[model samples]
Target: WLIKNYDYDLIKFLQWTCATPMKLIGKQLTIIDEQDMICLENDYSQCQPSQNSSIIK
Candidate 1:
């Protein structure tokens, strides 16, 4: 709820919380684009909006 309501950068949050710790142990981290990000629930929900796609905000 905080994430959706706050002016926070999701990508930065992932990098700091997930990627940074893994990199310290020599793990390769790939940065994904915003367009590739999707919020799913039970592998069926899509939360990102696209112009050419059918996903609605």
Candidate 2:
């Protein structure tokens, strides 16, 4: 619907959908609150391995 109505690129839209943390109820996607978004960002940032880490390299 969004693609047809707004002429959005399918790949970009899917990429955005995957990158943003949101609730998927059926076919509808709901936005996460600011607090949840901040928490998710912090969680991912803390878990990232350093570039110099042997495990990643």
Candidate 3:
């Protein structure tokens, strides 16, 4: 939804996802964008939980 709604690049998104800090709450994942203007939230009910929780940008 972030990529589609914000027109974010795939490579950049992947890199950002790799480097940026994130927060997880149960099945929800939250991360700030590079511009620091948006917060992306993803549901990971079908996947494993993430390990890192650093703030982005």
Candidate 4:
């Protein structure tokens, strides 16, 4: 909405957002708080599960 609702002066806003952390899809998220710092964190399960071939035996 920022791009559409705002005028041509939003260039800075766009730049700042690029620096901030971003929330990823599927149990992962990275975001920056009001303090303007980068924060990265995600659920342990978000990582791709490893296959256990031994269990198939």
Candidate 5:
């Protein structure tokens, strides 16, 4: 619905759905790659979930 109504892309969707909700409760998240490399929000598309990649608090 957001994609159609608000023209949200993947990054915006994640920020609104994940980060925004977390912020509402005072929590946060960090995405890491397979090598434990931190994935910045600008590179959110590269943070695909795998056996090693993770979303941490």
Candidate 6:
């Protein structure tokens, strides 16, 4: 529900992967194309529980 509504940067993320921040790959792949960036945004900032003292949102 939450993960699906965000903006996922598949290209940039994959590029970042296996490098330093993520390290998804090593010295195997030499490039990243459009297919590699299949997914994109995922903003969960709006995921907040209700504070009505009755039920959780």
Best by TM-score: 3
Candidate 1 lDDT for residue 31: 53
Write candidate 1's Cα lDDT for 1-57 as tens digits.
Answer: 656776456554553342233213333334543433343343233222223445458
Query: Residue 19, candidate 6: how far off, in angstroms?
Result: 11
| Residues 1-57, model 6: lDDT tens digits | 323764445435533442322222342343644354343344223223333336548
Give the 10-residue window scoring lowest on summed lDDT in candidate 3.
21-30
TM-score of each: 0.22, 0.22, 0.23, 0.20, 0.20, 0.22
Residue 2 CA error for candidate 1 (Å)?
9.9
Candidate number of the best lDDT: 3
lDDT for residue 53 in candidate 3, whole number 0-100: 63
Off by over 4 Å in 6: 1-24, 27-30, 40-57
Q: Of 2 and 4, which scores higher on lDDT?
A: 2
| Per-residue lDDT of candidate 2, residues 1-57 (tens digit) | 554666334534443344443332233323433333333544544343333435444
Cα lDDT tens digits for candidate 3, 1-57: 656666555545564455333332232223444454233454233233345765699
Q: Decide which is better by lDDT, 1 or 6.
A: 1
Give the Å shift of residue 50 in candidate 1.
Answer: 29
- State the TM-score for model 5: 0.20
Clashing pairs in 2: none
Give me candidate 2's TM-score against the actual structure. Answer: 0.22
- Quantify all predictions' global Cα lDDT against the true fold: 0.39, 0.40, 0.44, 0.38, 0.39, 0.38
Sorting all predicted structures by lDDT, with the top scorer first, yields 3, 2, 5, 1, 6, 4
- Clashing residue pairs in candidate 1 (N, C-alpha, C atoms within 3 angstroms): none
Model 1 bad stretches (over 4 Å): 1-10, 15-30, 43-57
- Checking candidate 3 for backbone clashes, the offending pairs are 21-54, 21-55, 22-54
